[model samples]
Target: MADFNLSLFDTSPFFLTGIPGLESAHIWISIPFSMFYIISLLGNFTILFVVSKEQTLHKPMYMLLCMLALTDIGLPTSVVPKALCIFWFNLTSITVGGCLTQMFFLYIFSGMQSAILMAMAFDRYVAICNPLRYTTILTNARIAKLALVGLLRALLIVLPMPLLLSRHPFCANRIIPNTYCNHIGITKISCVDTTVNRMYALVAVLVFVGIDLTIIAGSYILIIRALFRISSKQTHQKALNTCTAHIFVMLMFYPPFVFSTLTYRFGQGIAPQIHIMLANFYFVAPPMLNPIIYGVKTKEIRDKVFKYSCRM
Candidate 1:
């Protein structure tokens, strides 16, 4: 009986499902997925390159933009290649170790992205609300420290996830109904009681995302008040323009993220394929759109892009 029970809890390889009911169209789907991946790579790399080359773009806001670009690059790169493999070659099997590694990177980058967005919100708040002391308050050293903090915070929060998962023995049904591994998805397949895992996941989301959103909301509220105090219409327009890109990027990121997270836990009536597609979109859309939005909205980046294109 003991050996039989052990066999049932064997840590076998997990087979990832591409799209729950859309397996027939995976090859066709890969085309758009490939396009988005390529665009994300080029767009984010361009942001990084433009920022590095332009001396004038060395302010705190641009520095934070660079961090955002890095996370954008990481967020999709963690999942897309493996997804492509599954779509193109029918290679859907992922080892336990491999799945955990993917989950770690995916969540770490996601956490880092949230942290960076929060930092960027602070940057905008300072730029708008405390323009005179902005340089002094957000010096290069301070920016570096903030970046380090973001990285460390994400690492600390996500490190235990895989460790927790590693201790749990998976059941015979090792099939994950998604293109990639995530904490909840992996936890759901365990035969053992996963109340602790679910609780931790909820706590992590609230602590990381909830706090960040609160800070961002507070920053924007102060920013709006500051703008209102500036009676000069032109000054208000200029200040508001500076924030449009970040606001658009936030819109690109948070809504889909919140929906996917909530739907996964609460939307049991939702189709599995719908959940899977939304999850994939949550990873893909922000990375692909962030750079494009920034490039179009920020004159400096747009100007640099044009200059480089002219040279090429």
Candidate 2:
């Protein structure tokens, strides 16, 4: 029994968690989560498909856009399958090794997505604010380098999470009370104390996602400042049009995330359910709404989607 690998994939015996106090909330939660998961899968995939099939979108901005679409697809793909099983099929059992593996991929997509978003913001900043050198600034080599940086940074930062998670020993009552296996919940099951894991989580967040988000914010500020300096109406209009999607996406992407961090870090024990719910939303909402928001707000992606759909 001690040598058993209790992973969901290994032994699909356990259900993730049943409803705590209110059974009705189970239906409410499961229904919406299922809807969100399906939509996100479809939306992100559609964007990727259209962007890939179209020849006109071969430029740097479109390349970055497609990369974002890919990340969004991968982020939820890592989460939703396990979540669906846990939520609906009653298959929640996961081994310590499996949980650590899941967390590694989870962190990879999260970190990679953050890095890609930062790169896209820089692309926009250069395209609109410095068109005189935009071609040279984001040349083919530079774009490839940015993509390499995102993957490498993600690889480097996320490796520690699984390594750290593996070192912890799980106890008998390993029924993690969440729809998916996240670090906070997984760490809670460890017989060994989880201070080190939490510290590692904080460090990874700081170095990868946190710093990238801060840099993204600063990039946008500079962009806005540049917007103010431009005297011509057309330039202002073009800048505003290009940036509006990014600004809204940033607003959607950042504020909930910040509050979510405080909630998960500080409120976990006191309000585990609420914190867990918020953490679930952190992945679901961003990946789900990103394509929709960007497509609706930007004409290019919207037109491309329409064109591809018509052809299909």
Best by TM-score: 1
Estimate the Cα RMSD of every predicted model relative to the unseen true structure.
2.9, 3.3
For residues 1-312, write the lDDT of model 2, one tens digit per residue: 543333332332223574344334765777877788788889988887877887776778878777887877777777777876766666667655666677788778877777877887898889777899998789767887899988998898788776665655566777777666667777776677788889988887778757888888888888989989999999899788887777776776667766766676776465667666777766778778888987897787899888777987
Please give the lDDT score for candidate 1.
0.88
TM-score of 2: 0.89
Clash count in backbone of candidate 2? 3
lDDT of 1 by residue, 1-312 (tens): 333334224457899988989999999888888898899899999999988998998988888888999999999999999999999999999988889899999989989989999999999999999999999999878998999998999898888888777777787889998899988889988878888888888888888889999999999999999998999999999999999998998888888888888899999999989878878877877899999998999998999999998999
lDDT of each: 0.88, 0.74
TM-score of every model versus the real structure:
0.96, 0.89
Question: How does candidate 1 fare on TM-score?
Answer: 0.96
Residue pairs clashing, model 2: 6-95, 7-95, 16-92
Quick one: best lDDT, which candidate?
Answer: 1
- Residue 4's lDDT within candidate 2 is 31
Give the per-residue Cα lDDT of candidate 2 at 247.
70
